[model samples]
Structures are given as structure tokens and as C-alpha cells.
Target: MARFRLLPDEQLARSPLRELWREFARQHSAMAGLALFLLFVVLAVLSPLLAPHDPYLQNDALLLIAPSWSEAGLVQYPFGTDDLGRDLLSRMLIGARYSFGIALITVLGALLTGLVLGSLAGMSKGLKSSALNHVLDLALTIPSLLLAIIIVAILGPGLINTIWAIMLALLPQFVHSVRNAIAEQLNLDYVIAYRLDGASNWQVLTRVILPNIWERLTVTASMALSTAILDIAALGFLGLGAQAPTAEWGAIIADSLDLIYVAPVGVALPGLLIFTCVLSVNLVGDGLRNAMKKRRDN
Candidate 1:
């Protein structure tokens, strides 16, 4: 049997998205990361049906039960029960929903905010641009997690507040990155040609600048998603986000902390999910960056 593969087309190039997929698929790590990412997403979506027991349901007798592989462990609770007697697997499935929600909402919100503000900063001149840059510089000095904590402190903690905090914390990074990218693109010969050909600022931005810089935006979004996941988990771990019984991964681990020695698997499972989620996003981002490098300038 013969095998076929896509090669980057020079003159008659494929559609931009299709070409990107071909490039992305070339990386084995990226493909595996994508698979793992999708698996989590599916689990999150189907949590209600897939979960054997109600996530919040507590069985007084099942407290601190080890995993099913353990001799005293019960078959009904595959991952066993937490100290609170809640099913670990059910809680994790439910928690994944919040994680994915935070990722998507935070990424989109930050991206939109960054685009509008960064474009203004990029296009403006003199004092306006200087002031915007200076403010962003100050904001960036605070790490994303710290910035998120500050916002959450003021807003008060909950799932919604956590989402907003992560989005705001991520905003400065996207703004700076976008501003730099836009500034660089503006000085390029093609952009100048567009300006000379009577393209309005909006037209140039929508038609040329954005299309050319999508790779940068996508990579930034990937990074933001991973950061958002970590921030949500950290905030929960710190007792500042997603209150008890919500099944958020970090809070789940917090509830099971006392059981770390008697039931290490409970704490480790949520941590493992968080680790894998962040790892998958980083791998995908790295793949996109490498693929973008191979792409010819638009």
C-alpha cells in the first residue's frame, strides 16, 4: 500500500488553515498532546452521564477508601472516595468542566481585549502610545498568578470571579505581544504598499495585518489557556477560588490533603490532570511556533 502526505505548496498554496493542520500534524508530540486535550474535553462534556456517582454525594462508610486495585477498595468507586466520602472520579470529571470553561473564556476574553487595545497602542503616536506602553509595562511586572490573585482579592472569590481574574491577568501579555507584532507588521513593505494603495487603517488591519499575524495570536492564546488553568487551580488551592463542593480540581486536592499519606492517589490524581492539561497546551503551542517558522511571510 502507498502512503500519501501533504507537502507545503509554494505557488499554488493550500488554504491557510489546511496548510497549518498539515504542518501541525508533522509533530508527534503535538498530535499526542491534541489527543490528550480532546480526551479531557470529551470527558468534561460527558461528565454527567459518565460519572458513576453524584459528584457531591457523600457516603459516610466509604471515607478514605483506596483505589479499586487496593484490597479493601470498593468496585463501585473506581478511583475510591475522598476523605469527605465523595467519589474521586466523579469529582474529577465534574472539575474538568470548570477547567475547560476557564481556558476558553479566559483565552477569548483576553484575546479580544488585547486586539482592541493593542491596535490602538500600535497605531497611535507620541504621548498616547508611550503612556499605553508604560502602563502595560507596569502591569506586566506583576506575574500573571499574582495579578490574578490581586483581582480575585478585590472581586472576591468564586468561579466567575476566577475566570475574570485570569482574563484580566492575561490581558497585559496579549496586549504587549500584539502591540509588538502590529508595530512590526506596520513597518513591513507590504503594509506600506497597502497604505499607499489607499487602504484604510481598518481595511489594512482586517485584510492583511490580522491574517498575517494569526500564527502569533494562536500561540499567545495557547499560552494563555495553560496559564488560566494553572491560575484557577492555584487560586482554588489557596482557598480563594471556587468554594467547597464545587469539584474544582484544586479544591478537590485541598479537601483531600489530610489523606495524602493514607490516600496519596486522591491528591495525585487531580494534580496529574492539571499537569497533563498544561503540558498538552505547551506542546501544542511549541508545535504551532515551529510550524509558523516554516511558513513563508504573507
Candidate 2:
């Protein structure tokens, strides 16, 4: 049997991803955001083992309990209880998994669909590209949240439907961004050189243009992550996503609204989680954009 060999250290140091990581690491805000995001991921992954109580189990006697240390609070329910008496900490942990998982799935679906359509649009000659652009523009005119709501309404309310709805709503933005990037690259010296060297259109696109535009795509994806999280949460808030008995962050907040005055912490905790997650993602996206700009300048 033949033995496999790893790349030499010098070659590894020159890798684009390694270079990108070095750049990303230098941005303190970006590193902080990454840390916070990773913490959420860890919490989500370990929720089953870490959460003290079953998220669904309710105790009527403990309904609307306050956080521990409050006069009426119990030590066992540190973060308090929801209206139905579900443990707030446990529900929030499980909600982290649901919210992040759904957002990631939706973004990935949109990214794949967009890349395919956008590449085709960018490479096409005349009429096909024009038609695709027109359709994408029409889709872009509507706000993504509104479009998502319309889709969810049409599809009927449910978790899977909300995912599909958000994915479709986010698709146009990715298509527009990728198509423009590819179209711009098509006229560049590198692309012309590749063509002159007898490289096929697909080869130039896959091996050259795609690599050059990857940084932009990553920034776009990060921004889309925040948007997807917010949109999914909005859908859940409206009772159109991750239906009752499921521990989704938005659903938790929505369910606690009527008791906001009575148990403000119950409503605030989940909302705080949503805000922190979205803010961190946006910060990371901004940091990436700045880093890419500096890289191009150098």
C-alpha cells in the first residue's frame, strides 16, 4: 500500500485559508465575536447533557417563578420558569440548538441554490442572463422578512415550511451578489489570461474566479446568517415556526409576552440571546469585509 504524505510547512503557511485565518485573528472584535458564537455552538451541542430539566416538562406550582435569589425564586430553577412552568434555562439551551441549527440549514440551502443560478447567469450570453437578472431583481424588491412571511403563509405554518420559506426569501440576494462578482471577474486580466492559455470557461470559473471571489461569498454568508436567525425568530414569534411545546427562542419570547410584567426575565432572556447572536454575527461580517479590503489593497 502507498503511504500518504502531508504538505510541507512552507506550502501550508502559504495556503489561502491559513492566510485568511491570520488576518481574521488580528481583528480583536472579530475574534471576540467568533468566541461568543463558538460558545453558543458549544451550549447548543451540550444542551441535552447540560440542561438540568426536560425542556417540555411543566410544573403548574412553579409557574412564572423568578430567577433564583429573588424572594419567590427556587434554587433548582435558577433562571426561573415560563408561564407553563418549563425551566427557563433548559428551554433557552434547547432553543439555542433550534435557532442556530435552523439558521445554518437555511443559509446553506440558499447558498447552494444561489451559487448555481448565479454562476449560470454570470456565464450566459444574452437573453437567458437578462431574464434571470430580471427575475432576481423582482424578487429583491420585496423585503426578505415580508417575502418570508408571504411564503410561510402560502405554505402553511410549520417548522419545515418556515425553513423553506426563509431559504427562498434569502436566495435572490445571494444570486445577485454572486452573479455580479462573477460577471466582474469575467473581464479581468486573470480570466483573459486563463482563456488565452486554452482553459475552458468552466475551468476558469471553477479554478480561478471562484477562488478569487470566495472571500466576498464568505462575508455574504456571515451577513446572511444574522438575517436568517432574525427572520426565523420572527416567524416563530408569529406562531408560524417551531410550534408550541418546542423550545425555540422566539417562540419562548412570544409565549411570555402576556406575562412580561409579571416575569420580565422570562421574556428578556431569550430576546437577549437572539440579540447577542445576531450582533456577534454582524460584527464578524463587518470584520471580514474590512480584512478583505486590506488584503486586496496589499
Candidate 3:
């Protein structure tokens, strides 16, 4: 009745993902951020069904109406109408789809490209790794937005070109992070043990090193999302990304700039949404970083 048995080694081993999630949930700010982010994602996904009017439709009679509840506003145009008389609320909902969709796509592209390049550099030695490192350093020397702008300018203004430009601008940071993580893991005792156990170089890199480095990469990816969104918006604002009638947030702001005094909300609303999205993403990244740090300490 008093005898007890020890748990199996497998059962004793903690789940890293579960542990990380526990830590993440302990952070109130991070939970709030995650909720806000999910709300926007749902809004973006449901835009077509939920939007009250055609984002691109024009009616001269309804132009420049203030948001409902404003002294001069109309209930029919809750967020008001732009100079072209397009419904601002409807345009913004659709813009969420464009803005967030492009950001997600660009981040994914950058992550894939970076993982391939970085893995190669990380696995290599001497001159080869050095050359890759040098290239990354050179790319890092330029500001990301400026580099994106230059790339967009060279490729000519359009949606696909802008996505490529943003992806290219983001690629170097991921490459650098992954490369460093792999190189550091190579010197660890577990890697040496795996090699002594007759593990192939490929196995050591893929099975041993990659799994250990995934947390770092995840953190990098989360942070890069915010950067990707900002870069996309910047390109759109400069008329190099999404074009007219597309309902992208930055394009919306750009089109409404001349009407700032006449319809300030038209400009402010998009900018606020962009700010909120970026802030939420950054908060989530910060939470992950903190969670990882705590896990390591434990």
C-alpha cells in the first residue's frame, strides 16, 4: 500500500511545446495580443460576406460624409465615405484582406528562401560559409524599407513585384539568424555525441541541430511578420504595391491624403489599424522570447 514506482523516462521528459505554451499563456499582454490578431484575421477572412457595400463603388452624392455620430455624419455611412464616395468601412474590411494576405505571403516566401540559404551556410565551413556570411552582411547594411523601395523601383510598380521586393528585403535577417543558430549548435555536446554514434552529417544537421534551432527560428518569424506588414504598407503608400480600386490600407490612405482636412477619419483609420496590427505581432514575439528565456532558465 505504501510502495511507489518511478515514472518512465519517456513520461518524465517534458513537452517543450506544452511548456512554451504554458509560459506564453502566463503573459496577459501576449494573450490580449493574440486575441486582437485573431479578430483581425477573422475580419479579413469574412470581409466579402460582412462588408455592407462594394469597396470600389462610387456615388458623388455620398462623397466625404463624416463618420456616423459626428455632427455632420450620416448613419448610412458609419465610417463615412471617401472623396470618391466609396464606403470607408467596406474598403477597410477588404483592405485587411489585402494587407494581411500580402504580409503572410511575403513572410512565408522570405522564411523559405532564408531557411534554404541559411542551412547551406550553416552546414558549410571555411570559405563557403564566409562568403555567404559576407553577402548577408552586405544586405543588412541597407535599410530594409529602402532596399524594398529600390527593388520595387527596379522591377516596376505592381502587386507581385512589391511582394517579391518585401520578401527579398526580409530574407537576410532570417538567413543570419538560422546560420548563427546552426553554427552554435554544431559545437554542442549532443552534436558531438551524435557524430560519435555514427550519425551522418546530414542527420546531425537535420535531425539534431534543426530541432534545437526551431524555437529561435519561430521567434524570428514572428518578429519578421510585423516588419513584412510595415514594408508592404510602405510600398503600397508609395504607389508601388497595390494599385487603385484594390482596397489596400496604404493605398486607401494615399488616395485620401488630399481629403485630410475634409475627411480626417479616412486617413486616420487605416493608419490606426496598421499600428494596432504591428503592435499585436510585436507583443506576441516578445512573449515567445520571454517564454523561451524562462524555459531555458528552468
Candidate 4:
């Protein structure tokens, strides 16, 4: 009798989307968070078409008009108008693009910087290791918000400068997290075995260690993104972030402080958006962490 080998069919492969939905359902809180986040993302992306008017264009006649529900109603401005007569809803939607865009860039930059620094520090030992580790520690010790404010003050308030400020503030935390993760992986038994088997340090680190810890790294990256979004919004609220006339959530809120009594939702819309975005990101992060942890345990 001849022995036959069988190859697994492609259809047998796992479904990532199904797995994701299952995970989402498993963590209802996170799922809710993700839903809110996705909603905001959709809103941001569709702002140009969905918005009642140009976010920048103003109508003095419609300025600060109280929102009405009596007739389906009130000229398409659901959230009301700002002090500048700009549609609050329109600004919030447009602001979503800038706010989310900056946060994503800030996190990516930080993650890349951290990954490189951490990998180098973990790979090297003795004085090189100690020096690099100490630098990362010191970097983390510095207060990010204060540093961002100072940097922004010096750079002048604008979207580009705000992104740079956020990146600078966020980089240290990324460096620390990545360094710790890498260091832990470097000392694992598998790594030692790989090294003993004549694997180069680079080979052990990249091939043996990195592959094993990639899931954890992915969780960390997502969590960092959530934090970055909140931090950017906070910076904008402080007036050290994205400048005026750019539809920034934080700036919108800051600008609406005076009109809080007259047009509450003008402040509320962006405030609510910031809250939901951050909350959603955090929820998604928690879900990812839990799922990854469970997989590891299994």
C-alpha cells in the first residue's frame, strides 16, 4: 500500500474577522468602546459630505441658535452653532479628522522610536545597556504634558507643532515599554537555547524573541494609541495644541467655554467626542490584551 500525504485546505484557516467579533462579544465593554470609536471614525471620514455647512464658513444670522427638535428640525444644525457662527456639528466632525490624524501619527512615531531604542538597549549589555536603559528611565521620568506645553509654547501653536509636541511627549513612554518587553524576552530560556545553538544575537533577538512577543507588542501599540488620542485632546483643551480655525476638538471646546451657557452642546459635542474616542480605544486595548493573555495561557 502507498502512503499518501495530505495538505490542509486554505478554507480551514482561521477567520480573523470572526475571531475579532468573538473577542469583541466576549468583552462587551470593549466592544461598546470599539463601536463608539468606529462611529466617530465614520463621522470624521464622512464629515465633508454629512456636515450641514462648511466648518469654516459662518452664518452670523444662525450663530448660537438653540437646537430645536420640534420640526425634524432647526435647519440641520443638531448640536447648534459656535460663537463664531460656525456649525458646531460641522466643526466637531472636521475636528475629528485632525484630532484622530494627529493622535495616529504621534503614536506611530513614538512606537517606531521606542522599538528601535528598546531593541538596541536589549541587544547590548554592560555599559551600553546600562546607559541606554538609564536614558529611557530618565526620559520616562520627565512629565510629558508639561514638556509638551513648553515645547508647543516654543514652537508656536499650530497643527504641525502640536503633532511634534505630542510625538516628543509620547516617545519616552514607548521607549520604556518596548525596552522592558525586549529585555524580558532576551532573558527567556528559549533565547538562551537559541544562543547556545550558535544563533547570532541578532538572530536570537529577531527570529526567536520578537516572533514570540509580537502579540504583546501589538496590544501595547494599540493601548499607546488610545492614550495618545486623549493626550492630544487634553493639549488642545489647554490651548497648547492645534491652532484656531482648524476644527480641532480641544480648541473647539476651549473656544466654547464662554458660550457654554448659551450653546451647551457646542462644548458638549467635542467633549463627548473626545471622551468616546479615548474610551473606545481603551476598551479595544483591554479586549486585545485579554485575548492575547488568554491565548498565551492556553
Question: In model 2, how large is the Cα lDDT of residue 133?
Answer: 96
lDDT of each residue in 211-239, candidate 1, tens digit only: 88878999999998898899889999998
lDDT per residue for candidate 2 within 145-199, as digits (tens), equals 9999999999999999999999999999999999999999999997999899999
Prediction 4 global C-alpha lDDT: 0.76
Worst 10 residues of 4 by lDDT: 8-17
In terms of TM-score, the best-performing candidate is: 3
What CA RMSD would you report for each candidate?
A: 4.0, 3.9, 2.5, 3.3
Model 4 TM: 0.88
Model 3, residue pairs in steric clash: none
Candidate lDDT scores, in order, read 0.88, 0.89, 0.89, 0.76
> How well is each residue in 1-298 modelled by candidate 4, as lDDT tens digits?
9987554432222554455445557888877877887887787688788877899997888777666653433767776677777777778778888888678778888778877877887778899889877877886777777777778989998778888887888787777776788779877887788788999978887788777766666777787777677777778888777767779888888888887887678788788888778878888888878865554463
The segments of candidate 4 whose C-alpha lies over 4 angstroms from its true place after superposition are: 1-24, 70-73
* Reference-based TM-score of each model: 0.93, 0.93, 0.94, 0.88
What's the lDDT of the predicted structure labeled candidate 1?
A: 0.88
